[model samples]
Target: MMNRLKAALAASAVMLAPVFAAPALAETELIFNSYLPPHDELYQIAIRDFAAAIEKESAGGIKVTIPDTSLAPSDRQYEMVRDGIADMAIVSTGGVPQLVTLNKIGDLPFNSPSARAASIALWETYNTYFLPFDEFKGVKVLSTNVLPGRQILSVGKLQAKTVADLKGAKLWSPPGALSEAVKKLGAVPVNSEFTDLQEYVTKGTVDAMVMAPNSAKGARVLEYVTGMTQIPGGLGSLSFAVFISQERWDALSPEEQQAIQRAADGLPARTGAAADEVLAKLAPEMAKVPTENLEGAQLDEFTTLLQARIDEWKERAAKKGLSDPDEVLTFYRDVLAREAKASGS
Candidate 1:
């Protein structure tokens, strides 16, 4: 009888031991939604690296998952995050102008010397001044980045030799500062989503487009592209942001928040570096494509037009109640200079 009782007790202990040894579930699972395809360079740099960093920093307490397909369209990203459809998303500031007005300071033509400088400057400025704006009220901004300026990608034999050449040209334009600048440059701005650029160019709906190299390559626009005008300082660099839902952010403990921030701290620079590397690799592929480098008198003319647009931007910002737009611009330029000098760009 004693042996049977001991056997029954041993069996009960074994069953309970299995349950007790099980690992604890993660406290949070963040779902990151991205519009870029899985294999795109930006996806690898911004989405993959960010997710990995967060997972590692959380030490199994938080997990991040990116869906195989984008949860929402590019323009709807901000709304998706704010509405809790996605925990986090990568969104372009130009794509959502109404919600990201102040952040467009980086989008001014010839604003920063390089992607690295622009990205760092944008991130720092956002933390300093743009945080108080109502535009960012419903989301927790993680980091900001900029592309390596916009170059003119023209289909067929068209070439923009000078500012006068741009007159009457039909150009596909992204919204915000770039669109405004394109109009001022005497090009007829044909507004469209970046994703639809190839169709528009192929159909001859537009004669040229101002876009980042990596983005143009990814969109496969190069297949129809016959010539490229590499403008110095470019038309402008598009600014991007990684953000999380305010509701989701509030749910995290202070330690968790810090852990996430630690992962995000250097993301802009990392992304900019990654983009530069990818562009370098893609350069050879574009070797046979006819290209012109804007310089000398033509380049100076473009730069002058850009300055006038900058003044206009300042006026708009001031009208929106941002005090000392000049100071803000000066601060951004200073940051860019410092970053450029430090990076030897």
Candidate 2:
């Protein structure tokens, strides 16, 4: 009887051992600081895609949350993320040139027309010309993409046909060349974010601004902007970058890293598609905003004047010890052209 009892107890111990030895996986939660307002389609898309990818890759061991409010301006996003106020973020380097000037190539009037072309050319520029990890110290760069081509929106009916049309007009501008461009065009440049741009326009704080359709719509500037002049092929598309803290990034396992990269790998295409959707959806509403797609003689005239402004930028970059300003400009042009050809744009 004793031997039978011992045998049964031994079998029970063996059965329980496997369950006791199983390890519990560690779970991590990360956050994404968006430069977009809450629930904007692009913002939502990024959040959903990133969360899904991370969760799927981690097998419920990791999670990501994207908050809606742009708590910081576009310029401050990099610092905010690096400081670990947020684990990851999307930021505009051009908006904060003092922190990273090499990315300012996006600010030049390189005249990229389509988002697809712009995104491809931009990634190429970053890979070929820009310094990698050092360029964004303390942060792990994930992806960079371009906004759709920007258009000049004014508060009044007076079309900006020539440089002189901007005489003494007050315009809201982002930092760097875009601001300088405003000054060169004889408009006063007031630094403002999209959240405040419409208020400024409504209050007559500034007379006009240059922005993409999605931004113009997101900011509800359609209600305030008197007109939009499409400046395709005369100005470069704007760029935004996604980054994560190196500390948190390094902690992620190989599978998690690949999942994050995969999300970034498809970002340019995803963003471009989202931009197209926003443009299509916003067009009819923009019609009420009194937009004119400038082309032909008007466009030609504007292009000539804008081209002349490039010399000033070159001179400025030279003053700042940017070796080979023309070379930089040429490289951008060549890459942009190549991307256009490849994309059939």
Candidate 3:
């Protein structure tokens, strides 16, 4: 009778085993390294929103943490993720040109008129053509985006009425194609990190800078600038890539991977929209600073000058072994055109 009771107790314990079983996996936490401050719209939309989406989609299986301090410099973000110093980061393609060459396609002059079109076109191009290049070998790319149209912001009495007015001006330029374009347009391009721009401007080292309106606003450029010169189709746009370390990416289960990707879907479009919002509000933000919108003959002349620079870019790209450089340019242009029309911009 005791043996019968013992057997019955063991059966009951087995029947209740499912209620106390442990989970199949532990929760995952990822570190997101960012150079931009939390208040920056791009940072909020791209990093903060992305983190929230990942957490929700993973259903508590994953959590992304963005520390209050930056883990690496803006230009070194790609290297930081590759070396495992950070799990994920947003890097400018132009910042690490040696590693991210194909992104130069978006850097071409007059590629797109607005950030919305440029961002969508850039993402589509990256997935369709640039993905196979091994440029981003150490990381898994989440999304790619472009800044709003580049404009000329001059400091303390420098005003640009035409492309010719840019000649002899000491213009601040970030590295890569934009710097080259600045030189081609006869300005003395001062290649420097964006962080040092304020100091440079305050010290009277640069007469002007080529940047997007939102970027200028974030940098508080109006404090040093007297006015802005806006160009049709913009001078050019910069490309940005969000990515995760390959090791961390590979460790994630297929379901986790899909979840993260789903959360990242349409991120480029969202970022573009955020940029448009910023652009729309710039007038009030810069109420004290004068602004000019180039038109008619001046606009046509600027377009011609940009075309020359575009030709140079194609030649340089061909030399770098990008087969059919013209084809790549044409593809990007067509994508931008389609996107702009679809968005009614």
Ranking by lDDT: 1, 3, 2
Residue lDDT tens for model 1, 193-271: 6678888877889888888667777877877887888876678878899989989999999988988998997998888
Q: How well is each residue in 127-186 modelled by candidate 2, as lDDT tens digits? A: 765654266788876766676776678876657765677788877777666777666666
lDDT of residue 137 for candidate 3: 82
Query: Which of the two candidates, 1 or 2, achieves a greater TM-score against the reference?
Result: 1
Prediction-by-prediction clash tally: 0, 0, 0
Clashing pairs in 3: none
TM-score of each: 0.90, 0.79, 0.86
Residue 221 in model 1: lDDT: 86
Best of the candidates, lDDT: 1
Which portions of model 2 show Cα errors greater than 4 Å?
1-26, 67-74, 234-237, 286-301, 308-331, 338-345
Clashes of 1: 0
Better of 2 and 3 by lDDT: 3
lDDT tens readout by residue for model 3, 258-285: 9899999999999888888888887676
